[model samples]
Target: MPHSPMEVTRLTATDAARAARVLDEMRASTLGGGRAKLAPRPAIRESWGRMLHNGIDPDHDFRTDLLSRDEVERRRQTSRLRHTLPVLREGLLSLADTAQHIMLVADADGRVLWREGSASVLRKADGQGLGVGADWREETVGTNGIGTPLVSRRPVQVYSSEHFVRALHSWTCTGAPITDPRDGSLLGVVDVSGPLETLHPCTLALVDSVAKLAQARLRDLHLTSLEQLRAVAAPVLARMDGRAVAVDKNGWTAAVTGMPYTNRLALPKSLAPGRCWLPALGLCSVEPLPGGWLIHPTGDPEPPLTAPHILLDVSHPRRWTVTVSGQTGSWTHELTPRHAELLYLLALHRDGRSASTLADDMFGDPARTVTVRAEMSRVRRYLGAFLDHRPYRFTEGAEVEVLLPEAPLDLLPHSVAPGVVRARAAAGGQAWVERAQR
Candidate 1:
């Protein structure tokens, strides 16, 4: 437990044997409740708690049903991870093949989407149920690299008995989470794994660096998309007379005229040529352009509004609902999980959150403003006059409340947003104390 799993010094043969013995003792103590006096490292112990709570059997090797070949193909086609594969392969596969290790890429749900490397290693992997379509989630397979890193939001290495399931003790693996640059949501995991003899302390650093490269590539892709949108916006803005701006489908500002440039503007859910109230520009006429929408300000002033009450419901796993009530009555909008996390964070800091602060909260990186701006623009579209921005906030006088899941751990289960993670941890701690008292 002295060194983190990722920092375990390159193991000498003697060190490796000792570490193996210690981990084996920890596992025996955990599974049999015997007073085998050894403790797992903090990270592994924490992962073990989650695995036990999730009902994974320590003695059993469990593999959930694999996705159908058609289903697997569909996920690959739609996954943002598709863009990261080349980076992962270039960075890890070559090295892995030489070391007789296998490379694996799994989606956010921990289903292996791609596997490659030494043909012999791959064939060996099949016997351990580590082929494409295999489910490697901690709940199903016990603590290991792929699923554990997703939970920890950091790179991890599981060596020998550090694995929760007894049958996986012969394997050692290192993995890192690949996150979407736009929203910081986990896209999937990139892993290199092999027999115990192949364990290398440097594997964690290699996978971590490659994961970052994938995110950078995603950022480059986003910039390219914006460039294409800007080209489409140029001709449309040339003929405009009033204050106007052109924005892509996601509301990224591509071009602006007759007004100060804003990073982004919120657009209505269904984009059509029509008059709609815009939070940033008051009332505007929205017109369809080639790759985006052109907005022309009508110079109409926004009507004064009474204070409103806002309620965010994040109790459900797959659906998030937001409702606003004001002098004009109440309206509700279903939110995507990403939007729900943003609104919850904003509500937590009602004074308002700047784009950078929100970016940090959502993605764990303050510099990721493009994604934050784009998502906030969409939130504004739905919330309308009830929301305000400079630093984004609910309009003054609005009372905001968030409805959480019944169990703290159930709250936004798939969200890795920093604020959400803190909230979940706080709630979980309180829940545990309550149970202990009972």
Candidate 2:
């Protein structure tokens, strides 16, 4: 958030209409819904308040200063996203690495979403108008995937000549929007952009790969359903489609059975037990309906549910949420004392610690170093399949550590241009790669 010297001098465009329109479209595309707009100069749709509250306020200098701490926190998060995003990007980039100068995971709006490329590549794309969460389209930002796909609502490969703007004629871009299957809403776009000379016939393939991976990751994370709730200590009842299903480790669903669900129904149907695999949805013990078959999913020594019940060790790499009830003693997990200790250790030191220290700290004896290391890798490997940016990784000559925020973590863009981060003249992003490669 701290403005570099250039930021203090570089004033943003005061195009309220342009900015407002971009914001409106973002919400509609991401949420699969729109805000009611009233016409007047400088007036935004009421729905925008929630989102506007979150963006970096272009108008306020001090707000950026206040948010400086947030950047530091965000930088820490970048490490996590880096793990998964780079992997996701490989699938995307593998589609057509040469023609592709950059790959990005965009939010609902046309913003950069997320970016992966050498710092030089990112800088070049930025000059060409590409960055995490920036509005892009051949029409808006010139021949680019960001806006074009959003407008078209499909996959597109743009050569320099196809650009809506003449200047974009030299840039080749391909993009595909990743949509939410439940509602068929655009979650974001996977785009590739670079010079026309660098263009390849398979650029569209790259777009598809990125889009697929991002969507898959989102699903694993349980971001797909607003109905899906996450709880640390809430009672859980699993349902398939809409019927009750076997609970997960804590209360994640194995399967659900009963009448075919007509609509979104809560768990704990009194009728009869039927079986079906639970898709994914809300999990508060106190749904509009009664509770489902409560199961003890925790190991021995149990985790203390100071707050009722919550889901533990549910599946990931697809989106899911656990809900805890406000009521006390309604839910609990059975964790072995050792498991609880490990969980507590993770909670206490989410920012991370070297594997050596962690092993010694938890094991309290040098005899179990191999066992501890194996366990640490197991933790990473389990999530490696579905989740991106796993909890543990090697740092400083294979010192294993957990990479996360000190507090609750949110998944956003991560992995900035690694070395020699360059400031860019292009508004979307800086050409870090170009400067760095030099």
Q: In angstroms, how far off is 231's CA in candidate 2?
A: 12
Task: Compute the lDDT for candidate 1.
Answer: 0.77
Our tally of clashes for model 2 stands at 61
What are the C-alpha RMSDs, in order, of all predicted structures? 5.7, 21.7
Q: Could you give candidate 2's per-residue lDDT for residues 1-438 as a string of tens digits?
A: 212212211211233233324333332332333321312111111112212323423222111012244543464354223334654656765544544476665544454546665456777755644444455532235324655565445576654433434455445567776665332445556677665555555557656766677666655654322224323113333322333333322233333344332222222212233221121322222222222232221222333323232333312211222223332222222232233234334434446545555565565554556666666543332222111123332221221222332111111011111110111112123222122223
Error of 2 at 314 (Å): 37
Each candidate's lDDT (Cα)? Answer: 0.77, 0.39
C-alpha lDDT of residue 324 in model 1: 68
Q: Which window of 10 residues has the lowest lDDT sum in candidate 2? A: 412-421
**How high is the lDDT of residue 339 in model 2?**
34
**Candidate 1 C-alpha error for residue 172, in Å:** 2.5
* Residue 231 accuracy (lDDT) in model 2: 34
Which stretches of model 2 miss by more than 4 angstroms?
1-87, 94-100, 137-139, 220-438
In order of listing, the candidates' clash counts read: 0, 61
Q: Model 1 clash pairs?
A: none
